[model samples]
Target: MTRRAKRTRPATPQDEHAIPLQQQVNVPVLNLEWIKSRLNPATLERLMQVWGLVGRLTFPPSSSGKAREGSRRIPTADAHLLRKAGIIEEASSTITGGWIIPFSVVEEKTNGLRRRWIAWPRDKNRDDPYKANAPLLHISHYLPPAMAEAASCLDLKASFFRVSLPRETRHLFRCRVEDGTLVELTRHPVGYKAGPEILQIIITSAIAGVTTVVHRLWAAPPSVRIDVWIGNIRIAGSKSDATLWEAQVLRNADSCHATIGRTANRAPRSTPSWGCSLVTHTGRYP
Candidate 1:
């Protein structure tokens, strides 16, 4: 059999975190009728508790029957397993949103029935123009020939909930619970403007250091780079260095009380030592 030469490809899209302007048109603004219709009591209560540990929920005085505009609830499923896992509870009224901003519920492929909160740019009375920042670590920048031989990727669990919101901005995210009780988010919510940026800063600062790899001993720590885009972090270095960095990340997560999902191990066993040579300007990767 004859073999054909590999085909070329186009540049990879880097805007995984971006939301185009046109897509913002349909996010339903929150109202009493819509929330009551779609809000799952169990899910809301659970989110409250989960966020509470990270100082995301706070009980303030009642709204005095005042109405909060541009707030809404997204669809969610109440699962017994979630409750059993101690991540969800049966009761508690909690609401969150901001001034006149259009809020939408985003369904993620990996999120199951849980809805993500998103503040739309097209909403009226907007104070800040939303901009999506590029991911700090570009594949080409972080994974040079030497480092690409081994790498580790770590995903933080409920990373957004782990970030506490500034006290001054908490009021902007206020909403009313079932009994008309007013509460505000003390921690960063997924949809707000600065959430992703804030998270990147926190994670980067926590794991910023170079350490010697166990497999190779050197007089000094080898060159290691860390690039964090949102909650996902990639650490590339010598094999031993990657292992050491992974341990450091776990420790940092513990200190911050952040739960980390074990999706990728220290490094996949079958990862090729091809040094990303197969990658081209078209952004194809081996």
Candidate 2:
């Protein structure tokens, strides 16, 4: 009989510190309905926690001086496991100055559930260079009259403008028209610290002109109630300057008047006395 080779296993520490305390905790208790109702905030937080845990174990920090900094920032071993599971892509660090991992790899890993999670709107390109630096835009709200009309014209459920940046600093602009013209925009950055801001301006500019036209065509009265959200993209920092200009245009359009009570002093009230369903955008823009 041939001699059997000795089995070998990689060393793993069993100390409490070596093992994360979260691993000891039971799976998080979550209500499906509650989660569905408020999915954005909670789900994202939970997912990030899971990703962080995975990163720590799979890519522990390197001991050597130059490699130490790189190791400290490496994604968890679980991230690699996730990549193997088709939940995320194999983590690849960028050659750019920042030690950030590219967003493209993350996107490839997450592609299986792309629709499940809201993504930043941008043109899909297999060869485009800045794929890694691009941010994901998440659409939150759709503005009225414009939103309804855009949906009707485009035959889309929703629409949004998206932007992506590459290592060369060139930007890519894309219009994502689902059932209507884009009414809201959101972004999720992957690797670079300034990536989100760079993409936001591109997206904002692309949509601003069209949204302005829509606002002009759908001017309503002040008495008409209007609720506007700033959307998911942040309008601060160096990018704020450009975003502010776009915001001004939106504000001007939002100030238009609809046919409400004749007197300026009179408070306009809904005549139908029925609450508007959030699911449908049938009534007049408010």
| Separate clash counts for every candidate | 5, 28
Clashing pairs in 1: 30-71, 56-186, 56-187, 213-241, 214-240
Which candidate tops lDDT?
1
Q: After superposition, how far is residue 273 of candidate 2 from its true place, in Å?
A: 41
TM-scores for every candidate against the unseen true structure: 0.47, 0.23
Per-residue lDDT of 251 in model 1: 60
Evaluate model 1: give its TM-score: 0.47
lDDT of 1 at 231: 49
Candidate 2, 1-286: lDDT as tens digits: 1111133222122321242211111112112232122223433354334323211211223444221111111124323322232222322232111122221111111112111112222222211223222234333343334332111111101111112122221111112122222111111222222333232222221222232212343222222223222212112112333334324433422222111121212211111011111222344355
What's the lDDT for candidate 1? 0.37
Candidate 1 versus truth, CA RMSD in Å, comes to: 15.1
Off by over 4 Å in 2: 1-68, 72-96, 102-193, 207-282
What is the lDDT for 165 in model 1?
48
